[model samples]
Target: MSWMPPDLPSAARARLEAARVLVVGLGGLGAHVALLLARSGVGHLVLADADRVEAANLSRQPYFPEHVGRLKAVALGELLQRIRPQMGVTLVPQFVAPDALPRLAAGCTAVVEAVDDAATKAALVEAAVAAGFRVVSASGIGGVGAGLAVRRLGRLVVVGDECTPCAGATPPLAPRVTAAAALQADVVVGWIVGNDSGTED
Candidate 1:
């Protein structure tokens, strides 16, 4: 792809093409994260989401009127494949729990924790780490402002305001959500390139 710079060390390019990243959600955040990662040359993607798309998801998520009533993972997988014809995306059309992560992650080198719930996020992080995958996660992606930033804590890089929680009034907005996805993709790409200098928190 044009985006995969020719100057990148051939080894790094190979690593990216061989990398398998598990993105744990297919909503506002996960949608963009998966898209950006695919564009960045991450070859294989495992997308897990049980939820179906609805009209409500059109605002912040990358869904369209035609996508309503379709499975999120399926829809997103279709979109990704359209963007990168050779991109390999494994669609797991169910909510993957911690117990299922190891099997799902198998050869994956990185994990993106883009789920919406706190419980799921915590469990996925623990399991992804135990599975030995470099992880980047999101938290506090609610009601936007200028507070969103990236913080790398050891093996995990978290991006968000780190304050606002997703509520009715404090909903996830597209700009902030896409911004967070960009940061998450950056960290994942860094890991693929062997230059993951996680910022000091």
Candidate 2:
């Protein structure tokens, strides 16, 4: 697996090549976004996922069963390397503490929140805003129909909604989560390429 020349808008390709994108989860949505970014030639990817692959994760998560019990961050990093051997990535396996947000986001041009907890997502949103970084977040992605919604965090734009993951009241649809992840990646890439108008913002 080596670097395949990226086929993207010239400006977007360069921006992607030089950008640092911090992904906050490595579950279903995070897994898809991470894979897309790496394959698309994003220069730096900071992945944080304090969880490991569980049997329940196989259906949606892209990692192999051999990855079961392995830390999501590390496992995903390896998979990314296999996909695009030349991609540069820094995998962090710890949760992002409130106090550490600024330092984590220091040089990042954008942040993508894919954590499963509402409170944590809110905290990440606040942190990204505080750090003046653009953010693309996932919300209501699981328990819903296939859909895409892009929003804004302060003046910066994001790719998802504020709706919490559909709780027990509403059941989650498997296909929706997959679609949502692709939508999240699209919004972020659109922003990096300067095409996002936040029409749904």
Best by TM-score: 1
lDDT of 1: 0.87
Query: Model 1 misses residue 129 by how many Å?
Result: 1.6
lDDT of 2: 0.77
Residues 1-201, model 2: lDDT tens digits: 434364555777788788788888999889899888777678888899899999888877887989999999999999988887777789889988856877887788778788888898888878777777888776666455545676654645555444555446444444666777777777777767677646643
Q: Give the runs in model 2 whose Cα sits over 4 Å from its true position.
A: 1-9, 144-146, 156-173
Report, for every candidate in turn, its global Cα lDDT versus the true structure.
0.87, 0.77
- lDDT per residue, candidate 1, 1-201, as tens digits? 455888988899899999999999989989999999988899999999999999988988998899999999999999998899897989999999998998898898888899988998999999888777778999888776767777888778888878756446657778888888888888888888888845679
Q: Which ten residues in a row have the lowest lDDT in candidate 2?
A: 165-174
TM-score of candidate 2 on Cα atoms, chains taken together: 0.87
